[model samples]
Target: MSTPQDINVRQKPAVAATGGGTSTILATKQLTKNFGGLTAVDGVDFSVAEGEIRCLIGPNGAGKSTLLELITGQLAPSDGAIYFDGEDLTGLDTHKRIDTGISVKFQSPHVYENLTVEENLRVPLQRTDRDVDRVLAETLDRTALSEKAETGASELSHGEKQRLEIGMAVTLDPKLMLLDEPVAGMSVDETDDVADLIRSLHDDGMTFVVVEHDMEFVRRISERVTVLNQGEIFRQGPIEEIEADEDVRRIYLGENA
Candidate 1:
């Protein structure tokens, strides 16, 4: 079996700002996804700047998840293009995209319930040639799970499991991380903890594209917000700016906005 020490990941260099002084790490042009007759994601143009946090929000069926799938290569786009690290990644496979420094953590905790926290970290780094013990220690520290390293994943609290999942993603040393509803079901304290973690990572030069519905959490961690409506981008700006728009307030935010 492969071991963590045996895995050595080769990361791509960070891309500088391009195309009209925009330093977008990931960009999509008229990106669309369809399932036969139903268009899940309409032609949408989106972009994420390097080392920035961007949140995607909308009412149900706004294509937030679908847009995420397209960017991560879980579902191929029916039209448009995907650019990552300044290269075209429109038709790349999931694994290939991952190789290009993209990692994703879905809404649910996707951990190996039977494995210990340390073992979970070991599994992903097994193919790389990095030091297994060292990486494991670092990952535990980074995710705030060092004390629980020996505990089984099934025994971890929901928030701890979420952090563990994030730890696993970071082992890949990705430049951009996609998080879908990361703080869902987390307590206020837990949400704060995750937000702190995300900010810390961003401070360390990581870029993130997050999809969340909790406006409180969005307000806590979001630098910019993108509102999706019926498979298209309705508006994108600072959280305060998005909150002030009457149409967005009436449509998605309701009385809350």
Candidate 2:
């Protein structure tokens, strides 16, 4: 794990094309996680600048999800520290992290099938100082799900469910958002729509760290990317630089070109 001082010394200023604001919002120091004898995340260090849509790309079992879980407190790291908004969060619980404006959306939609779209959103709405009705209205409008707000979660198409999950994340007005494979199984059109939604959110000043396997989608949304392999960072740089690197291509992209 690297310290803030280490990041400042080694990491160049993140490029500005992706709308990353010039302030650091989240920082990690020598973050490590282990599950019994299995070391899932090994001393990873990174910083997410304010308003940047940073993407984490890696092969399966590369520890991307584990890193997210550690940051969100779904799992505690065996060592290292996490700092968000200038406060130490390495010791906080998941809900506590949420309360501090860190929200995570899993790959699978977690909405309640029994609940209406409006009701599904109400769960997170109940946690903030923001007015629930106002947040709900904004979320519905943003996701274009107003018409389906009264529809049950189970009634939604796969795309709609994905949008709803994003809407729920939006309603929280988080300082940092972790999206895990947000368009995992959507059609091409649906993938495009979700990509647009993510771009819009970034434009609206939201910071995001997305874990995705969709290279094209990642290229569309991320200005900078971090590659993780076998639990450690393999590369970190602007998208074009990463894409053109032979090592990155061999390890993650393969001959898919």
Q: Pick the candidate with the highest TM-score.
A: 1
- Model 1 residue 143 distance off true place after TM-score fit, in angstroms: 1.3
Model 1 CA lDDT for position 155: 99
The residue-level lDDT of candidate 2 at 2 comes to 79
**lDDT string, candidate 2, 8-106, tens digits:** 443332222112343788877788998889888898887888889999998999999999988899888999878787557777778888987888999
Return the lDDT, model 2, position 245. Answer: 88
Question: TM-score of the candidate numbered 1?
Answer: 0.90
Single out the weakest 10-residue window by summed lDDT for candidate 1: 8-17
* CA lDDT for candidate 2: 0.87
| Model 1 clashes, total count | 9
Leading candidate by lDDT = 1
Range of the 10 consecutive residues with the lowest summed lDDT in candidate 2:
11-20
lDDT of each residue in 34-119, candidate 1, tens digit only = 89998889999888888999999999999999999999899999998787885567767988888888999999999999999998
Instruction: Give candidate 1 misplaced runs (Cα > 4 Å).
Output: 1-22
